[model samples]
Target: MSLTPLNNIGEFALLERLAKLINIYNKDKVIKGIGDDAAVIKPDIDLVQVVTTDMLVENIHFDLSWMPLKHLGYKSIVVNVSDVVAMNAIPAHVTVTLAISNRFTLEAIDELYEGIRLACENYKIDIIGGDMVSSNQGLIISITAMGYINKENLVYRNGAKPNDLICVTGDLGTAYAGLLILQREKKTFMANPYYQPDLQNYEYVIEKQIKPEPRIDIINKLRELNILPTAMIDISDGLSSELHHICRQSNTGCRIYEDHIPIDMMVSNIADEFYISPITMALHGGEDYELLFTIPLNQYDLIKNIDDISVIGHITDANEGMYLINNIGEAIELKAQGWDSFKKEE
Candidate 1:
């Protein structure tokens, strides 16, 4: 068979070419998929629908050298699902679109989807529909996640009030620490081809980077405790960035205690090796995928003893401004320096 460029075949033909291989099914919920103007789905009547989309691009979002394709596939789905969960919703379906260069083979695509399929099974979600197209450069994956929540259980970023306790699920900075370690290893490997990557010592931080779990458990635990967050956002863009988002949306300020922020011992040890503060990583690092939320002061007693959660701060009047109080009682203005996609690297 002659090797044909994707441009020679055109969009419709390419779609037709890939359509035969797609086995996306959603039982009775997906009434329409491909060959239609839009996907049609039947949502549960008692649940309020929530939607979120995320994109990952090669080099920018991930490096193929360090990121396994299967893990990349799983991470993509998890990130979108994390957004849905952040809104206090349960993910039910996903639409996956891919843009790939000719460098990708059918086997490669299958490998990627294998991870997606695994995630779907794990999360109890369905792959309703999506699109596939050719790319000019490297690979790109975009996913749109749909979820549902009862109206009374819905959460938002603008519902925080003064005196609400600011809390975060799981430890922070582990992912960023993992990335730093990977980058350093990659550089060393590039310089010395015979050098073996020593990742076993950094297993926890490394796993935190490549296989970070979304805080679905936090949402479940909150429900089990009969508590609902007044305002909530996922820690995709670091704790400080998420805190700023909640404060800006809720029209409130916050004061977080540096000592109160949760950090894994492994992450702190790793940060020491990197010559950076673990607190700095927690404040500005991104992609931890934990849940950061605020609850009423009255609800504090309900969550005081929850494992893997920390009450790091409290909401204050907007005029008070966002500040971080160090252990010695020094207050520093909080800054949001999370990942900026558009900003050119210096």
Candidate 2:
């Protein structure tokens, strides 16, 4: 099959083709979409709007050699939607912007947008508007997601108080485990161009890395149970780093028991193969996209039976400091050692 170069198609024709791929899920809320100067939406009367943006740059955030454009596009939406879910909101619309080099074919762009469209379909969101521009480097995807929540239901990183139980939804560290598997396979393939990677056993971890889904179900479950988190954050930057954010913002300390931290069996097995501690992955590995939150201590019984949610620790007085209690009854001071975009690579 011949690949049509992006330059072969005029900008207007490209836009027309892209516009047809999007389907507005909430026509009642959206007044305008792709063709407009800016998308128009009717605001919810009683709910507050939440907006978040995330950028994935080639060679920095991802590598085209290993990362499929569709998966990258889907993940870009998931990452931003996770933020809205962290605020206890329902994601409604998104605007996708792209910076593409001439080397990428028009078909490549279609594959990327197909992923974006899938995400929008799954999340019941609308692709309202976005911009595409030429780039000299490589592809860059910037997505802005919008969500809405009632004022009373809004949760922030600054709301945790003493005696609030620290909770996290779903397993931790799986994405990083998946990333390790991908990197290992990438190295092997690079060394021998004809080598085929045996990835049947690593499907779970790889999917977590390439196509993570935000814990929107957990948000709905919390609402259904009538339980409101005092503070909440998505575990995008690892459990330890996210705990620090909640503690620092809420002006409280925390103590998380290592035994209480949830790690999937697959993640544990992969960590063993890598000769790395599973606990280390759980604590410091980023991009889980699970929800880390805190609720009043009295509400522990309310969430105890929920299989996916784990109560790992509790909030404490500001002077107590953040700590992680080991199985041996030792307390170690917790630190934010997760993903830092500006931190120089050692």
Residues 1-346, candidate 2: write the lDDT tens digits.
Answer: 8899999996777777778988988887899888978888997799899999999888878878878999998999999999999999999999988989999999999999899989999999999988888899789999999999999999999999999999998899999999899989999999999999888998998999999999999999999999999999999889999999999999999999999999999999999999999989999898889999999988988999998999999999999999999999999999899876544132
For model 1, residues 20-104, the per-residue Cα lDDT tens digits are: 4445445556676556767788876787899999999899888888888888888999999999999999888888899989777
As a whole number from 0 to 100, the lDDT of residue 236 in candidate 2 is: 88
lDDT of 2 at 5: 98
lDDT score for residue 282 of model 1? 90
Which candidate's lDDT is highest?
A: 2
Off by over 4 Å in 2: 343-346
Candidate 1's TM-score: 0.91
User: Where is the poorest 10-residue window by lDDT in model 2?
Assistant: 337-346
